[model samples]
Target: MNKSTTIWGHLSAAPHRSLFLAGSFQALLTILWWSIELAGRAGLVAPPLLSGITPTWVHGFLMVYTFFPFFILGFLFTTFPNWMNGEKIRPNRYMAVCLLMVCGVILFYAGLFAGKLLISAGLLLMLTGWANAIAALFHVLLTAPAGDKRHAWVAGTAFVAGWLGLCAYALWVLTDNTDMLNFSRQAGIWFFMLPILLTVSHRMIPFFSSRVLENYVVIRPFGLLWLMVGCAVAHGILHLLDLQGYAWWADLLLAGCALYLSYVWQFFRSFHVRLLAVLHISFAWLGIAMLSFGLQGMLFWLNGGEHYWLGLAPLHMLVVGYFASMVLGMASRVTLGHGGFPLKLDHLTWLLFIAFQVVIVLRVIPDILPFAASMAPKFYLAAGGVWLSCFLLWVIKYAPIYWRARVDGKAG
Candidate 1:
């Protein structure tokens, strides 16, 4: 027993291991849910078995809440201590939370198919687990001995906002109110996901750029970070109120600032290194998402709120283009670096990175198809397939590294 435990101690004794376990598990689930969505949209099956929820709602919930959080927590739990120069986190703390999340997602699925009671139970468990993870990170932030800690605080605050969003979603689920659910979803995007990602991007991208580029200097002022947060919050409120007409102004200003900051931070110069290039290009997607948001809002206002472009394209641009690409880029860097592999990008990994953009473009096709109404289903199916394929490839490439002991003979 001792021998077996010792052999696998690396996996069980590390916070990043716990997070990677959760992340890889949910990556599979992410594809599974999306595949089901593809089938439903293609009219090849009956409606989803989950009562009181539409298929699109399920997709959004799992995509935004389920798998993505695992990525964020994985990144933060591993990186936060480094950011603050704090002590390493105990593995058991994160392991328990990871288990709760995994079980909650499983129960949510089981309830969707078998018993509705499990659905509520599953959501509750998931929220509890998420809250615990946030608390753990916040504890680290509060106790850190000596670092800037400002970025960590910003991330911690966004996490709290996410917690509140989850609470609201749970309330809406219990009440069965469509409006509240919609509000919660929008909040999940603008409040939780976007803010957290942008905060991390603001902190890490410039730092990474300066590290790799010889002449690069850190030029993104902290004030711009606050501005982005303020804009993100306002964007969420406007979305919640369905006041999208005015939201474009907020988005445009935010987009302009983000682009300007990227230039000042020398993001363009970071493209010289392949690994840094991945981070730089993925970060650019944020500006693109902001641009999409502004364009969508302007089009809606011009069309007298008739939604000429419908809001789907811009949302997908953010979710798939910005969020997923960043996750892939960061995950690759962290996973390889921690596993004691070289950070250099190989052909296969580069292909995987490019495929992510293809997935984003494919997903947006349905919204932009010119008078090809009958082809929308095919486009949707293709997009989901491409997405699933990306993860499938990712799992094959990285799962072994995650499960085995680290290459360096060092404790995590």
Candidate 2:
């Protein structure tokens, strides 16, 4: 092999130590949160630490900003080298940023549990960590030698913006500024949530679906999707400005987007793969989320309507159904493929996937039924149990693969 080929191979073959560390932290956090919830249910604490804004906010923020970013960095490190035709990009800075973020997460959570001084200190640390991570990512993106890699650039930028927004929001919360907090949340979602989801969904959905449907055609143009995103951002801004009277118009824009994305679905159905089917199914939830939010906005226009819990429904659906499902599916695929295992999933894996879907259903369906709110926590617990089990199974099944180099002596 030529030197270039050898370098590419080495870059690809490098151990994903960071990815594993981050994944482990994510899994541990998930398990810990659930355990706290379960304890609350058993009436152990006065009011469980898991019951309030601090826990929920910290959990959500860390999951998005802390846990997943590591995986993102690891993935980019592995894939970008190959994408750039074997150019090496050392990840020492990225790893350092990750470590800083982890420390920030711990400090932030501790402050929430402690009091105001801790909260202030934690926020400062978090901001510093996030800024470093974002800077490191930007440097990597600029130096990576890939031309017009729009998706990578978009995802990376969204992540940075999202974390920055989070930092601002944290400060607002510290100051007891409700308006700023609300605005920050809306800004953060647009800056972070939609972009990251679109980037990942676009890359993975078609690719994974194509695995089952040999003839699957993955559509590439996302101009229309970006337009929808613009509308969503506008809606967020209007709501923040208390001009939510115009929110209905924004919803109309999303409704139109739902229609367009539906066509994308029809195109996918033409290929017909079960693996692909799951992706389409998740996207369907996204479309449904858009429509639901639109409908809620319309209701608000019709009357002095309240912000319904139903909004949580679609958000959870996107997070758990679309984002989590995609992550689980891709991680499973990559772990198996890189481990020199067969592409085919075994019975256990299939069952785990099904269980994940069941969890989504249980978590989502209750929103349509208010009386069922009492039972929602139970379903969440059950879902959490199943999710934890799946991850454990994954660790058991793929630990060897992750630990040992590829059996074929080929680079990952």
Write down the lDDT of every candidate, Cα atoms only.
0.80, 0.63
Question: Worst lDDT window (10 residues) for model 1?
Answer: 46-55
Candidate maximizing lDDT = 1
Backbone clashes in model 2: 0
- lDDT per residue for candidate 1 within 1-412, as digits (tens), equals 5766764675665676667767866877776776776787667876466666666777788888887888898889888998998766677778878888888888888877776678888888988998889889988888889769988888888877777877776777688777778777877888889888888988888888877789777776888888888898898898778786889888888888788877787766776877888887887878888988888889888889875574377788888888888888888888888888887877888888888788778777767666655677777777777777877888788877766777886556
Cα miss at 391, model 2 (Å)?
A: 3.3
The residue-level lDDT of candidate 1 at 56 comes to 71
lDDT of 1 at 276: 80
Task: Kindly report which residue stretches of model 1 are placed more than 4 angstroms away from their true locations once superposed.
Answer: 1-8, 45-48
What tens digits encode model 2's per-residue C-alpha lDDT throughout 229-326? 66767877787778876676766676576566647546456234444454566666666666777776777667766656474776676567766665
* Segments in model 2 whose C-alpha atoms lie over 4 Å from true places: 1-17, 34-46, 49-53, 80-87, 115-129, 144-146, 207-212, 248-252, 255-278, 307-311, 399-401
For candidate 1, the per-residue lDDT at 106 reads: 89
Q: What TM-score goes with each of the models?
A: 0.94, 0.80
